[model samples]
Target chain A: MAEISFQLLLLQLMTGLALGAIYALLAVGLSLIFGMLTVVNFAHGAFFMVGAFLGVYFLGLTGSFWFSLVLTPLAVGAIGLLCERFLVRPLYGRGIDYPLLLTFGLSYVMIESMRVLFGLEGVPTSVPAELKGVVDLGIGSFPTYRLFLIVATAVIIGALWLFIEKTRYGLIIRAGSRDPEIVRILGVDIARVWLIVFGIGTAIAGLSGLLAAPTRAVNAEMGIPVLAESFVVTVVGGMGSLPGAVVAGLLVGVVFSMTSLFAPEYAELSIFVLMAVVLLVRPQGLFGKAGLMG
Target chain B: MSNAILSVRDLNAWYDRSHVVQGISFDVNAGEVVTLMGRNGAGKTSTLRSIMGMLDKRAGSVVFNGQEILATPAFSRFHAGLAFVPEDRRIVPGLTVRENLQLGLIASRARDTTDAMIDEIAQTFPRLKERLSQEGTSLSGGEQQMLAIARAMMAKPRMILMDEPSEGVMPVLVDEMFELFARMKRNGVTILLVEQNVERALSITDRAYILDQGRIVHQGTAAELLADDEIQSKYCAV
Candidate 1:
């Protein structure tokens, strides 16, 4: 066995945290959609893939990473809004299964459409010069982009928390998540709220995808693995709980990273293991209310 | 008929094939507190819900302010100035008392004046004023009920359809709620209340209707209903 140094462990921990941040971003969006709309968005991963492709398209057009970063989420979010209006809205009150199935099918359509338009090959994104290279920590050196990812995600999550906890629309979203019928009776156009929530949820997912592009391949099938892993994060955190998604995401990320360092083969398997243990121990997830899904 | 703010004619409603409100008819005049008193499952709540457009299957001529609203959606019905305070007093979890009150103005024309409206409403319910920052659901049962009523008032509604506000509340708070209703009546706000506390409800009501098995079995002035103990025991028995 190779001797592990303290610096190496710290580096692995930082890497894990960065990975976890991305997972948290994706998982939180999933949780928000589920919480507000009560629809399991199978199309989330596809939205992520769309974001990356949009990033590639926009970056190629402007040769500016910043432009792609700003444009991808807006474009993808608009797509999400349209989807909510046309696809998801019709299926509500018909029961959860119809929307679930509709989104399941929607994911396939998104993936196939991307494949047809962009071709089957994976696209690569180069990190911006300002964010490239390594920064020296007292313990060791870490990539600036990775640190930037962590900071950017933290800022975005903070903003999202403020939106949900402080703003009036956020109040509606929170109340609507708990009892949509009551919110409706209060004269809120609940349909509009759902539309905006889907837009916001997919917009965040799109942002995460763009952020992931420099580190991971941008391909038609790219969202598949991330999608599966995010579902684990969401379940472990508890469905429909925002804070739960964030905490569980980071935990899963660190666990996966540590496993990757110690036993490379078990890295992916470890996420499932963690999920299974959490389910057996606390079925509602760490922050999820009991019987919410039911 | 001209003075009636809410006029219901042959209102029928169902809950998944079980007809809950069978052709129930009633009229609530402007600036008067009207009560619908009944036993459990007597369709009192159903009648209110149907008027509020909450029931999916219903047939009725519900003319609110002279506009037939049976075909409009629940939210639109609210936009037409019909506020409903449900029986459960659903104080939303994870929301503060201030936020709970904010829910009342979310879709109202008064939404732009949220803080001012809250301050104005807080003066009336002193209990809620002290706990504006506290989570709404964490409050005691009575406080939650107050929050629900205060929330409905935030809409600045022309009429309020209150469902069992006195249910599950402390006797002291029940008295407070009735007192508030009396004050609202004095201020010229129309009210249609569904209550299990027959005597307390009748004390403040102008007229009372007793429902039995989805139909109106008795309708009379509050004084007449209060004097008739036989009608109360026969229809509103626990």
Candidate 2:
């Protein structure tokens, strides 16, 4: 039997946290879309992939990382907004199943379109000059880009939290998620709210894609595994709970990282086991309210 | 017709294919409390919802402040000085009382004056004043009804369409709510009310319309409706 090493565990923990940050970003967006619109957006992964490609294209056009970072989400958000207004809006009141099926089809279209445009090979993303080095911690050294990703993700999540908690629109969103019929009767333009929510959710997914570009090999098939992973994180976190998504993301990331360190074969399997345990014990997910699942 | 603040001409409403409110017509003058009284499923609630543009399959004319509004949507009707307080008293969960009131303000393009409106609402409903920070779902049944009314008042509406304000409320709160309605009428806010409590509704309303099945069977002064026990027995059982 191999002896446990504290140093190795610490390194693995750091990697897990970094990976969890990305998952949290993806899962929170999914939760918001599901909570507010009740649409299981299978197209979310495609949105992320498109965002990565857009980020690369925007960088090529502008030669500025800052511009791509800002523009990628906006561009993807517009597409999402259009989709909501034209496509998803009609499916509402028909049933939940229609939107789910529509999004599934949308995902296939996005993937195929990207394959046609970007070709079959994975695109490489270069780390910016300032972030292309090692950061020396007191105990160890780590890549600066990885550290930047962790910090950037934290800042983004914090900002998102503040927006949802403190803003007028956020209050409406929270209330609407529970009872939209009441919200509509109160004289609110519920159609507009739905559009904005879907847009924001897709934008965040796209932003995650852009953020992941430098860390992963960007290809047509990249979105599938990540989409499945995001679903696991969302379910484990308690569907539609922002804080739940954050906690579960980090937990899943750490567990996957730690498992890979010890038994590489069981790395992916660990996430499913945690999900199964959460399901058996608390079917509502970690932070989901009781009686809300139906 | 010219003096009336709200006029409904042959108003019809439906839930999908089910024609619920059939040819219901009524009118309310400015600053008057008008009641629509009926038994269960007599289309009284459907009449109110149709006037507010809440029912998509609704047809016929709703003229508020003398502008034809049959073509208007629900939210747009709100901006035109109409407010609706439904029977359910839909208090949003996870939102404080103050936040719920804020939603009312958002509905009628009254968001900019939220602070002053909130202060007025607090002053109007003393029961809601102390519990402004409490989650809306935590309130008692009567208090929740009061909050729903107070929320509608946030719009500073010219008129309010209320559906069964007395439902599930204690007698004391119901009396208090009627008194509040009287006070609102005195202050120049018109009301179109729906109620199952025929006796209590007659005491406060100037005029009453008794609906049967899906149409208005009787319309008269509140005193006339109260005095005519025969009309009451035919349309309203209680």
Candidate 3:
């Protein structure tokens, strides 16, 4: 009984980490957009769903998951670019509420459009052949795809960190996030920066969705749950903080997975519970600096 | 007029409903350091902001480099060789001093010379040379002011609109800043300065405009303004 319980614990921990990885990716994207543009992206989940759908569609056309992985984010990012230019650009300096409401409405439009195009049925996606199966560790067996998810998220997040810390454009993004007017006066076309930031944010969402496709049923309403969870993650991690998102995502995931093992019904509820507890302890969230957005 | 690098005429600005800068006109010639001196709320800052295209509700004829640029955006103004150093010295948080300096070159064609420019800036501002990796906001007020000015110089702009560079700085550092401005002036960079330090300002300035209630009350050469005690006592006692 002890041996079985230990193995179960390890399995649950691994699964939890995989789930956290996805949440981190989604939350990081949301935080990045909010940090730079000061616009809470309500349509982030919809972008995730779009990414999955695009991935599935691309896979079907090319019969290659790798192609889908590489192309989906680019395609979805282009869509994000258009959305920013047409929808988000006009609302800048009008305060945050306008963009919030706009993105809220945009989420509905994107969801309904997907419903119309793909129908209400949940489209199934298959795991790539190489990633399909289990990897036997010394202590236990774990799904290979879940491991890949964890590794891939780490790599992507690492690259993003380096980009933000090392590159010149990244420097502008950081400075612009603090005060765009200063950046503008310094000679950078801040409008273009906003557009590109929006693209990158949604592209990250799209990649998360593609990663989630094989694990979850791909449907119009699929983003709704993940979106809620990601918001919870964002709040728990402290809104608009990248590192906070990452740590909070993994913590929420582990809590969620551990709860599922003991009581399946409380698994979903556990994430909110963790958020509430974190909020009670630290109102600004785990790593959030107060008055940052204000 | 042809030699004037920045010329503002019939300029008016409003913040929301309050009409702040009312029909102010000023000129800063090429390779000249001009001071805009006035009491608090006299709209000296507003005039510079309007010229930089930072003020939204502004209408004016601001000619720079022989072109009318009242309609141009703020970034484009910078691209056209106009730079601004705001009074507050907005050093971006979470970015290193090096990264902050790099922001000055972000949208300029002079980005290719980033390393050389940074090296030159480091040599000029020795206080910031060792703190390049430190977070910009962590620097002292004097160091931050220097960082702000150094960042502006990275673009190698033809002219700079400086707002109160010596405000809230230590006495020694204030002298250092004025000395740096003198060096910059010698390098042929035109400057339009808005300062509360009237005595120091006139010392470095070739010409000066004294603003009273959003209008140019007194305009003269620095020597003439220094000698005329009546105008100085009325508009620039502070």
Interface root-mean-square deviation, each candidate: 0.8, 1.6, 0.9
What TM-score, over all chains together, does every model reach? 0.97, 0.97, 0.98
Off by over 4 Å in 2: none
Query: Candidate 3 chain A: minimum summed lDDT over ten consecutive residues — where?
Result: A1-10
Which candidate's TM-score is highest?
A: 3
Clashing pairs in 1: none
- lDDT of candidate 3 over A1-294, digit per residue (tens): 124477778889999999999999999999999989999999999999999999999999899999999999999999999999999999998999999999989989999999999889957788889899999976688989999999999999999999987788888888889899999999888999999999999999999999989988999988888889999999999999999999999999999999998888999899999999999998889999875652
TM-score of each model's B chain? Answer: 0.98, 0.96, 0.98
Return the lDDT, model 2, position A268: 97
The interface root mean square deviation of candidate 2 comes to: 1.6
Over the stretch B143-186, how does candidate 1's per-residue lDDT look in tens digits? 99999999999978899999989889999999898999999999
Q: Lowest summed-lDDT stretch of 10 residues in model 3 chain B?
A: B101-110
Candidate 2 displacement at residue B35 in angstroms: 0.5
Error of 3 at A119 (Å): 1.0
DockQ of each two-chain model: 0.87, 0.68, 0.87
| CAPRI class of candidate 3 | high
Q: Give lDDT: candidate 2, residue A29.
A: 88
